[model samples]
Target: MLITIENRNYGSFKYKNSTAYVHYRNSVVAEVPIEGELVPARGKINMTTSVDLKAETMISNPNFMADVTSGSLNMTSTASLHGKVSLLKIFKFPATAFSMCNISFFILTKSIDSKCTSKIKL
Candidate 1:
């Protein structure tokens, strides 16, 4: 599945070294690591990435497949800010940041049969 995350924060704060996860019944099915600045003040950053699912893992957990097919899979993310200061390009300040954010959302799948029709009849 293709996962896209957009940061809509309108502040000086930025998200760095971020990671997103796909969860099924509280277990992580996939993990995607993201690096770079995400969304600026009054601006937007769209990051598109993907994760691969193991067939063995899915087969072992029948409920995971059921949730995916039913479009009930959930996604979550956690990230911290890049807090570093430099002065005159000669001196650097230590980062003293201890903050993070967690966000969650659900993935929904739509049936194509409701939108399009098959021309070839079997």
Candidate 2:
């Protein structure tokens, strides 16, 4: 599965050196680092990356597993993210966000159908 994490800095403090992890079924499907990067206040960290997730890990049926890439898998899954938010590049705090995306993968379309709405805990 290809996972992309976009973190938004809503507060006035700058966020830096954060890492994003995509969790599905209590397993980490994707991990991306926000190293040496900065998200200005009221700005956002945009990252595009891909991770290889085996079909067997997600699907138990052997007959349908082989056709995942052939546009046979049309489904939606909920994913959560965990990362660090650094203040002024000094103090770091843990941040958690939940993104709800409607996974609609087709044979001819490439579109990101996820939207994240989060409340960072201090």
Candidate 1 C-alpha lDDT tens digits along 1-122: 33333333333233357555544445666666666553434455566666674446545776867766666544333333354334344554433223222332334533221111111111
| lDDT to native, each model | 0.43, 0.50
What are the per-residue Cα lDDT tens digits for candidate 2 across 1-122?
33344445643333444445544444454454544444455665555554555545556544444545576444434534455566666777766554444444454565545544555555
Error of 2 at 4 (Å): 6.9
- Lowest lDDT sum, 10 consecutive residues, model 1, at 113-122
Q: CA shift at 102, candidate 1, in angstroms?
A: 13
TM-score between candidate 1 and the true structure: 0.48
**Of the candidates shown, which would achieve the greatest TM-score relative to the real structure?**
1
Model 1 bad stretches (over 4 Å): 1-9, 62-122
Residue 122 displacement (Å), model 2: 1.8
